[model samples]
Target: MKKILFIYFAIISLVLPQSQNESGYAFLKNGFTARNIAMGEFGAVGINDLSALHYNPSYLALNNKTQLAFSHHSLFNDYSSENFGFSFNLFNLPFAIGINTTKIDGIELRTKPGELIAKFNANYFYASLSSAYQIKNFYFGATIKYLYENIYIDDSNGYAFDFGFNYEKFYDNFSLGVVIKNIGNVNELKNIKTKLPLDFQIGINYNYKYDDFEFNPIIGYQNYLTDKISHLHFGTEIKYSQTVSLRLGYVSNYDSKNITTGLGVVFKKFNIDYAYVPIKYGLGDNHILTLIYNF
Candidate 1:
């Protein structure tokens, strides 16, 4: 089993982006689902079908069905990102996997003062495999990530690990989770001498149930360890009946565009999600659309 996993990971490494350089800014913008990004990237509880691989691996164990999700994002219609994720419970042991890519396409690497020198593309890709196991009131999980990147005359590649734990009371409305990412540099290549972008995060999710309606809120603190950038984020999912849902979120330090609005639907095994986020610094707004299926 371990060898198979290694082979699978090797294949993933071949296609991913190495987000390492003299400075590690590319690691900061590596992609994930926009639903999470809209919430200022606060994804700790992350029980959502698609984000299990990135945020909380324990969510895979809680689900018995298989899930697949894809997203399209427009960052002001110029630079954009595309993502895909899949997760399933295999052999009664939960497993999850994901793939994401960010392409800064349509930008000309200009000379001084807006003169076009040459066309360039800086892309980063991440592929991950994760698993979770249940133990009493807690679930412990881990993820292995493969990264790859190629830029103008410079290329680097590496691997990292993530660990997560979640605890929930059976009859309570509260849950907690903690996750740590970027554990080791399993395969460090040349010219990339820095450690991976590391992060530690804590999350809280609550659902207040009532006769007519229920409100679900999620709050989290994320600390990027290597950079010392700390942030707080929160979101609420308000639902009416079994059909329609609304979402809003806030994050303190991501940008001026902190608020988020989202719409959701559940129709048997099919789900559709949409999020609209306003601008922080640019002239255009951003939107993300996602579709998911669980079976």
Candidate 2:
């Protein structure tokens, strides 16, 4: 059973989403919030969103209120993820924390084509602590993360870091951001070490207002160091009265999925967001929902 489980995990580590079979811990590449997902997973150049703790921590410097956020992501093949985020201030400095837990269940163990011997589950988790400092209109931030993964009876632990910079003084309606992410290493899992997905990303965005509606368009470039691949992210959002938003996004250079759409609603101190992505090859679809409250 252990040997089979090891083989299963080896295969899984190679085929997880967004990494193109080149790196492990692919779950780290997923979007942190539904709004971000709806906007093509644009992590940089965020505006006061606590989810920045996962993408570009430098954006956390924009936070002036205490906020809490929760999200659930449903993927194909009985895979799911739960996430939590919190942001607050201490001594006039902004800080945020994030947690993610993912599970893949009902994995079958069979010795023959028509026979099933047993079923098991695989789990992954990561926790992060982040903080940002602002100097004039420039923000700098860093994040430290602890990662863990369990497959049947074998488990490994790891650590990583993310650093980010944001320039918001260029214009009132424009912002630019850059980040370096997943800089660390993981322990060996069954005598084989898994490689982290190291990445560098840069993004720009513009906000425009007309009458009672506002428009935001964003573009980003991402480079995966390990996979030697590059991708482009594009997204736009239209908001009415600052209460309701319609979002559309597209990500280039993916084999399984690309286009995404979603919406957001703001009610007093609470916000609700949803995102949907249709996968190809009959692999079902991806759905994400997030709720946030500010105090």
Best by TM-score: 2
Models 1 onward score TM values of: 0.83, 0.93
Global fold similarity of model 2 (TM-score): 0.93
lDDT tens readout by residue for model 2, 49-164 = 89889989998886655799999999875889999999999988888989999987777766556656688887899999999999988999999999999876778888999999
Q: What's the residue-level lDDT of 255 in candidate 2?
A: 99
Whole-model Cα lDDT per candidate? 0.69, 0.85
| Clash count of each predicted structure | 5, 0
Query: Which stretches of model 1 miss by more than 4 angstroms?
Result: 1-31, 38-40, 110-115, 186-192
Those runs of model 2 whose alpha carbons end farther than 4 Å from true positions after fitting are 1-21
Q: How large is the C-alpha RMSD of every model relative to the true structure?
A: 8.1, 3.0
Ten contiguous residues minimizing lDDT sum, candidate 2: 1-10
Q: Give the alpha carbon lDDT tens digit for every residue of 197-244 in model 1.
A: 678889888878677677878899988776677888888877778567
RMSD in angstroms, candidate 1?
8.1
Tell me how many residue pairs clash in candidate 2.
0
Cα error of candidate 1 at position 22, Å: 9.7
